[model samples]
Target: MGSPAANQCYYPNGRSASTDFPCDPGVDDSPCCGGGLGSTCLTNKLCSGPDGNIVRGSCTSQAWSSSACPLYCLSANTGGTDLISCSNVTRSDTSYCCDHNAFCCDSGVGRFDVVPSKPQTWATWSAAASQFVVVNPLSTAAASSSPSSTLASKTSNAPFLTTTPPGNDTTSGTPQPSQPAQGLTAGAQAGIGVGAAVGALLIAAVVFLLWKMKKNKKLLEGKQRTENTWPAVYPEPPKMELVGATPLRQELDGSYVPTELPAVTDRAELYGHRV
Candidate 1:
C-alpha cells in the first residue's frame, strides 16, 4: 500500500528505524542514530539544534560562526553556570596564559589553569599589582589612615637645628684647676726688680773696700824709705885730763919710757909762791 512497505522498519513517529534507510545523513548524524547528540559527529559545521544544546563536535577550520555555540556547549556539557567569551573575561590573579595552554576556568569554583610563576620583570610584584586598585596612590582621605611610624622614627633620629648644641655656651665658664691660665703675676714681677737692686748695692761696696786698701799700702811704703835715708844719733869726741897721773915716757927699743909734762898753777896760787 505505501510503496508496498519499503524494505525497512520505521518508528511510530515516522522516523527511520533501520541503519540502511535513505536518511538525510546531515553534518552531525551520530546523535540521531542513538537518539542522543554526540559532539564528535559535527566537526567543522554549524549546530542545527535548539538553543542551549551541546555542539556535536570540535572545530576543524577557522569560521565566522556565532559565539553562542561554544557558550552553550560549555554551559550544558561542562556545567559552567556563568559562561563568557575568553576575551571578555577579566583575570585578577597574578597569572598569564602562555603557549597554547587552554585557559580552563570555572564560574565560582576557584579552579583555573595558569602558567608557572617566573621572575617578575618589574622591580616588585606589588608595584605591578597596585595599578588595579580603585583609589589614587596619593589619596589620604581613607579611614584609619595615619603616618607610618617607620618614617617618623627616621625623621626623629635625623640631625636638625633644634637638637644641635649651642656654640656660645662652650667657652662661657671658668677653666678647671688642673688647667692653669696664662700670663704674669704681681708678686713674681716685684721679686725680680728687688733682686736687680740688691746686686747693684753689692758691687758698690766691693769698689769702696778696694780703694781704702790701696791708700793704706802707699802710706806704709813712704814711711819705710824716709827712715832708711837719715840717722837719728851723733858720734862723741875723745876726753882730755888736766892732772898727770904719771910722767910721760919714751921707750927705746921695745920698752916704754916716761917723759916730763907741763902742769898748771892755779891751785891756790901754788900755795902762795913756790914752796
Candidate 2:
C-alpha cells in the first residue's frame, strides 16, 4: 500500500553506505517480505549495540506505509529471514502492520517489533534502535585528519613565520616597540645661551641709569638750600684811634668857648673915664 522509495540503509546519525553483498531472493530480499513482486530491499550493513553486541541487519521499503522504511535484524528472526511470516502480525486498513521489522535493540532485550500507531511502543523501539547504528570507517578517518591538513595548508604558503613564546599571544598583528626620542641640536642650544646674556646686559644698563639720576637730584637739592639762607651778622668792634688824634668831646666844645681878655678890658674902661 505504501508508495515506492529507495531502501538506502542509514545509521541513527544519518550516515549511510552502499554495500557489495549479494542480494538473494526470499532470504535477503526485503526486511518484512521474502522478495515480493515489487519490493525494495537493503543489503546487510554491520552494526554494534551500545552494550557491545554485534548485529547483522538490512532495511526495506516493502509492504510498509511509513515514509522511512524499517530495519530488520537477520540473526534474530527465528523462523527464516522473512519477518511477515515469522512475526505473525496482521496489517490494518491503514496499510500499517503491528510487526514491521524485528529491530536489533538493546543488548539484553535483543530484537523488537515496532507499531506505527502506538506512541509508547514507538518511543521505546526508537531509543533502542539508536544504540546499534554503526559509524563508517572512512568517515571517521576524514573527520580525524581535518584539523592537521588545514594547519599544513596555512603554513605551506606563508611569506615568513614567527614562533610565539609560551604565555604570549599567538595571534597575528602584534605591536612593535617604539623608537627613542631625539636630542636638541647644537645650534638651538647656542641661541638660547646668547639670548640669556643679552637679557642680563639690558637689565644692568637700566639699573645704572636709575642710580645716576637719583645722585644728580640729591646734589641739586643741596645747592638750592644753601642759596635760601641769610648771611650771618656780628656787632662792630670798638673804634681804633689814630696816633695824636683829638678827643671827640673836646673838639666839639672848642667852637662854642668865650675869649679870656678879662683883666685888660676892665682897666681901659676906667682910664677913659678919668681923661
Best by lDDT: 2
Using Cα atoms with residue i matched to residue i, what is each candidate's TM-score against the true structure? 0.21, 0.22
User: Clashing residue pairs, candidate 2?
Assistant: none
Lowest lDDT sum, 10 consecutive residues, model 2, at 116-125
- Please list the C-alpha lDDT of all candidates, in the order they appear: 0.27, 0.30
Error of 2 at 186 (Å): 1.7
Error of 2 at 244 (Å): 6.7
Taking the tens digit of each residue's C-alpha lDDT, what string does model 2 give over 35-134? 2222222211222223332233333422222222233322222322222221212222111111223321111122232222111101011223221111
